[model samples]
Target: MRSVLVLSALILAGFALSFAVSEYTLRLLNMAVIAAVAVIGLNFAFGYAGLISLGHSAFVGLGAYGLAILTTKADWSPWLAAIPAVAGTGLAAAALGYPLLRLKGHYLALATLGLNVSFSIVASNWIELTGGTNGIAQIPGLTLAGYKLDGEQTFLWFGLAVLALLGLAALAIHASRLGRAMMAVRDDETAAAMTGIDVTGVSVTAFVLSAIYAAIAGCLFAAHVHFVSPDDFNYAHSITFLSMLIVGGEGSVAGAIVGAALLTFLPEWLRVLGEGYLAFFGLMMLAILVFLPTGIAGLLRRWRRPALPPQDTAAGLDGAVSR
Candidate 1:
């Protein structure tokens, strides 16, 4: 319940702020929300299940391209197209996960990284389907209650609503038995298997769930931008998604949301540095990594928690003696 309220407050705040920002800022904010969805899903894999996936953006691309093809090629409505796009992405993840999850640590990371690279190669070469580097264009926008979500502000309102619902769902998952099982696997796969937990199953489930979220974000991206190129979901974007999770604090839903928004807007805020902004961004990230290994959410938790009272050593000794 507390999690729900906090999520509601954040969504409402973002929705209210949308009306005041410039159109460009609103567009960035909407993108942040979409990224947040992907990052939250990532929490399931890397955060809870100890999976190192560098191919998250491939799933996102699959979703985006799936919807794009369905809407443009098959003449399907955006609403109906998202269904198969998201499901297909999940199925693909599951198929890949069964064989891929066998690898651990950096090996798994490298494999997933290869997966992203492979996706890029296929998306770039398959010009007939993905439009190659040119990407798909003229994709249709969504309609809500008879109104077109073509404008940034309108689209943001819709995006916020989706984020809120998904955030709640993520929080619920975090507190459930499934979530605990995933965490157990993350902490120690051997121990988890000894305790009758299905380690392989949890890992695959986490990967699939993460891919599903990425795909949903991709669908939203397609609907909002009305265009997607291979470049949009390249390996760089997957790194960005992982960075968002790390910066916001992995294993935390709130951290995911905060990280996405902060990183999305950080570039804009540093635009004053001109060409040097990238350097500054790197420095700040380094500082955060060194000082706050747990990320911003962990820092906030520390601040919110009440400090413990000092122990009375002399009184303790006296009490012990009397006892």
Candidate 2:
């Protein structure tokens, strides 16, 4: 209940703020919301399931391309196209996850990274399908009841609604038995397996779930930008997604949202520092890492708790005597 309230408050705040901000800011917010969805998905794999996936961008690309190809080539509606695109992306993840999830740590990371590179190569070379380096343009925007969400402000609201529903779903999963199983695997796969948990299955589930979320984000990206390209979903974006999870708080839904918003807006906010902005940004990130190793969510958790009073040895002895 508390979690729901917190999430609702955050969503309400964002919705309210959207009206007060400039169009540019609203656009940024939309991007942040999209990124948040992907980051939250990453939290399932990297955070809960302890999977290091650099192939996340590839899944997003698959989704974007899937939607783009369906809507443009097949003349399918955006709403209808999204279902197969997202599902196909999840299926791809499930198919690849079995073999890839066996690798641990850097091995898994490298494998996923290679996957993203391969995806980029195909997207760039397959000119007939993905539009090559030029990308697919004039893709249709999303519509609701004959009203097109063509404006940034309107789109932000729609994105926010999507984010809210997905966020709640993620929170529900986090508190479920499966979520605990994933955490168990993360903490100790050997122990999890010994306790009757199917570690492999859990890993695959997490990967597939993450892919589905990425696909959703990709669909939204294509619809929002009306463009799909290889450059937009690359290895760098995968790294950025992981970075967002780390910066926000691994294994936390709120942390994912916070991290996405922070990283998305940080660059824009730092632009005021002139040419030295990037350097300062790096330093700021470093400071956060050094001081708040558990991320912003951890710091907030600590801040919310009341301090305990110091215990006296005499009182302890008295209590002991009474017992």
Model 2 clash pairs are: none
Question: What are the lDDT scores of the predictions, listed in order?
Answer: 0.92, 0.91
What is the per-residue lDDT of model 2 for residues 85-125, given as tens digits with 9 covering 90 to 100? 99999999999999999899999999999999999999999
* lDDT, residue 265, model 1: 97
Taking all chains together, each candidate's TM-score versus the true structure is 0.93, 0.93
Task: Flag regions of model 1 displaced more than 4 Å.
Answer: 306-323
Q: Which model scores highest in lDDT?
A: 1
RMSD of model 1 against the true structure = 4.3
Where is model 2 more than 4 Å wrong at Cα? 273-275, 306-323
